[model samples]
Target: MTTHHPTQTTTVQTIFRFLLGGALILAGTSHLTWARTEFLAQVPQWVPLNGDLVVVLSGIVEILLGLSLIFLARQRVLVGWVVATFFVLVFPGNIAQYLNHTDAFGLNSDLARGIRLLFQPVLVAWALWSTGAWAAWRRNK
Candidate 1:
């Protein structure tokens, strides 16, 4: 007989999850406050909605997602999926920033922007790992 236990989260994973949640909250606050103008640079030109509106809305979303990550441990797997999806959804903005050479968040150089673009997938992976979402999905397969 084979016994398979679900993947359990480690202390490191919990810490990272909290850290990521805090980061998202801080970033979202910035989007609505001191860094609002800088965030504008990330809004792709093709997005028909007003850049200000988009930034504001995304800020709100980030805050809500952050809260979920921090407080929704019971639903962490779902929250992880949502957070990872959010990372994927925002990738185009990162790409647009890099391609358009729009400076924001001190990523003034193309290299810097390019590097930031590379981190999106890391964020997605982080969300999945920290919340055990990847483990859960894999276990079900």
Candidate 2:
């Protein structure tokens, strides 16, 4: 089997990471003001946190994660880890919404909601992989 250089792999992964971060930044911006309330509606009742607090916290985190990926080039490894962790941390909110049948940002759905639940893991994987996190672990071993 042919082998790839570590630098080449790192470059490709960095591009993917930037793209994903940009997308998330945009997604997060969509929820800042009026969108915040709309997004808050999707949070399930089972979540113990106050709805407003959740909205604020989620927005801030999305922005931070996006910014870290874009600006923290030297610390890519840490950024990757943080992004991956954030995804995992927020996943329950998605699941809670799915389970509760709550409207998400007022989006109309037809299996889209369920589709989103599946998509979350894919997103998590993308963030992890694009940040070279899987590769990093291999190296540290």
Candidate 3:
């Protein structure tokens, strides 16, 4: 919890927040379009719902979350938590992909899949930091 000048914090967070929003929008769009197969690779076999359905639903959720992240600054902290929870909720798919050695999104080998495993936390942290959700939690705690 290193502190920065409020101006710096606000500026940096704004940039990251926008970037994350745009990324989510793109990802969500892809889920319903050309990258549908790529996203399907991340859906674990254990899920009772059809993998395509899961991808579609998750994509819609991503779009909504991304839109909220960009447009709802007043509720950014709560949106951030929801976004982080989304990442957490989907992490099992990532793990299953790695364990099952499924290739998609150019992750062709164990090394690549393993590396991707590391980024999930980064996304969770990004959702938190870019929206001050972590700080809010800290304050409440």
Per-candidate TM-score against the hidden true structure: 0.94, 0.83, 0.93
- For candidate 3, what is the lDDT? 0.92
Candidate number achieving the greatest lDDT relative to the actual structure: 1
Q: Cα lDDT of all candidates, in order?
A: 0.93, 0.76, 0.92
Poorest stretch of ten by lDDT in candidate 3? 2-11
Query: lDDT tens digits, residues 54-120, model 1?
Result: 9999999999999999999888889999999999998999999999999889999999999898899
**All candidates in order of TM-score, best leading:** 1, 3, 2
Q: Any idea how many clashes model 1 has?
A: 0
Error of 1 at 105 (Å): 1.1
Residue-wise lDDT of candidate 3 within 1-141, one digit each (tens)? 986532233878989999999999999999999999999999999999999999999999999999998999888888899999999999999999999999999999999999999999999999999998887777668
Q: Comparing candidate 1 with candidate 2, which one achieves the higher lDDT?
A: 1
Error of 1 at 34 (Å): 0.6
Candidate 1: Cα lDDT at 46: 100
Off by over 4 Å in 1: 1-7
* lDDT computed for candidate 2: 0.76
